[model samples]
Target: MKETPSANKSPPKDDPRIDALIRGYAHLSEQVEVLTEQVKIQKHQVDDLTVDAILAEFHQKQERKTHADSPTPYGRTPPEPAEKEEAPKHLQPEKPHRKRQGLKLAGNIVFYSALVFLIISALFIRTTSNGSPRSLAGFTGMVVLSGSMQAEIPKGSLVIAQQVDPKTLQIGDDITFMANPTTTVTHRIIGIIEDYEDTGQRAFQTQGIMNDEPDAQPVPAVNVVGKVIFHSEVLGQIAGFMGQYWLFILFAAAVVIGLTVILKRIYQKEPKQTAH
Candidate 1:
């Protein structure tokens, strides 16, 4: 018996083309999710120099969406348009403008505050008694000027040394002491000499960490300043520079004041532009 025309027709097997199309759509959806996350991240970068990059990314996404919706030769229907949406709170024109204006105003306050801070800090760094930067909280800040304790304490590093009793000091303890009436050097105490010449002064043998030979003379205990407690490497360099050129520090302060005045005028104009 011969089969009818309807019986001759076979049911459609699973189509590889359909599977590929589904997979492509799934990949596209993942890419869109990743891009959306990236957009969220970039929105918070307004304070940096990347605001233009964020705008560029937004435009690129718009272009991609436009292209994805274009008609194709595969007889597939174009994607439907997304529903119209009110702007997200962060994306609203008015909110970001207000935030930007607030930031601009804050920048002026910050600049002036920093300028005042530098002036006060430079003055303190320039004044010193017995090689100590300043005495506060029973600690004296001292700036390192030599490579004697290189890599660890480092050249141009600042150390805060606290004044401690000579009896409390021990061999191998780092200390700052006056080598002469006008000179001070910081080194580790290698030897402690007691009862010297009935002068009631303890004697210490000291050596720099990087120096092969000990100091030319022993330091008297009365000259000892303190023990190293805290330090900053880069800040010490800035203090050293200001100490050598205090006049430059004042000139810089004046320049900052002038710039702050100019920026103040600019930020004051932002609100007017957005008033409408």
Candidate 2:
């Protein structure tokens, strides 16, 4: 057989087919480069648009915030945050009320003290039907039944006298003494008679202020009761009235106690009512 061209022989260097393959590969590479450049440009454009949108959104938000912070039109202001409210008058503690309560408490103390004093004084004072002077605790209480010392110590006046040494008695001093076994007399000493009848006893020459002459007899120092210290007409009348109507004292005390209780209850309830 004739030897045909070797099946594995190399092609010629200037073969048209090889040239065509190289040209096609070059064109494909050029197309890929253009497509990659277009992709890069599109991505840059998208990034720019996104940044502009974000900036616009931020500006709009800032404008809205500024509008909200600004005062309203026509000099009308925006509503401010609400201030804390004060407590109601009734709910709030009042200094004046506290002071008033203190004053009231003081007044109650004074009132009760006065009432106790009056009761004690009424109990200690003794009244007699014969109007004789009574002695207690070195003091004497005498009711003047006569007008012998009118204006100075009128009738129906109560005289308080203090016991003192007879030797210390002075002229022009008012003294109370026993004129007889049952009769008691209060008079001013005009003179002091010393060593009466040589008995070494002192006597007091007595006379009423309103009388025109001295007493019929000199008052012996032994008969002296006390020296007059205080006198009151109103107290004497009150004492006489109470002696006659002793039930009034009980009624008055009961009334005072009842009123005090009612007042205390009222004061106690007032705060509770005000709180409600």
Estimated TM-score for each candidate? 0.47, 0.53
lDDT (tens digit, per residue) of candidate 2 on 178-217: 8986788889999999998787999999999999999999
Candidate 1: segments with Cα more than 4 A from true spot: 1-117, 127-143, 193-202, 254-276
Model 2: ten consecutive residues of lowest lDDT: 120-129
